[model samples]
Target: MTDATLAQLDALPTDELRDRAFALARQRRDIKFFWDLFTHVTHSDDNTQDGWIGSLDASIDDAVALWREVTGHHYGDAEPLVRAAFIDYIMQHGK
Candidate 1:
């Protein structure tokens, strides 16, 4: 990505940046983007639990919470890397 593009994306709020990338991914039906998103969210710090909740209902809630946490920019220290990846993806495919 060009410096100008990077600068422009960086200027956006994290939530906005993520939303744009996600919207583009959805529009293009980009499996790789979704896969990467799943990987990132699952590998995030809070998801290191060894045991499953066992209940499908709880699991669904947990999944929803995880998505909200990450997309809401509450990803803690990983926020910068996540934002950068979103920016890079947008630069690469947002034409």
Candidate 2:
């Protein structure tokens, strides 16, 4: 992802970040893509113990950006609003 995109996202507060992330997750198949990439990245980071929302803004940004780049071309038929709610669930309750 471009620095500008990251910068734009990073500029938001946590609540807004949550809102944006949930909105982005509303994109078709976004949750599948995010979790697919997240699972892979987490496995790759197995040497380290990481948790939700990441430890740093850059790290979280990088992960999201990378996931987008890697799997953005394919989105399942999931409805925008549904996955967005899922993202909100993850943001609110995921470990």
Q: Which candidate is the best by TM-score?
A: 1
lDDT of 1 by residue, 10-53 (tens): 99998888788877776776656655665665575565444432
Task: Look at candidate 1 and tell me the lDDT of residue 7.
Answer: 76
lDDT of candidate 2 over 21-46, digit per residue (tens) = 54455543354545544554345345
TM-score of each: 0.66, 0.29
lDDT (0 to 1) per candidate: 0.66, 0.45
Model 2 C-alpha lDDT versus the unseen true structure = 0.45
Off by over 4 Å in 2: 1-19, 22-37, 40-58, 77-85, 90-95
Q: In model 2, state the lDDT of residue 25.
A: 51
Model 2's TM-score against the true structure = 0.29
Misplaced by over 4 Å in model 1 are 1-4, 44-66, 69-72
Quantify how close model 2 is to the true structure by its C-alpha RMSD in Å.
13.1
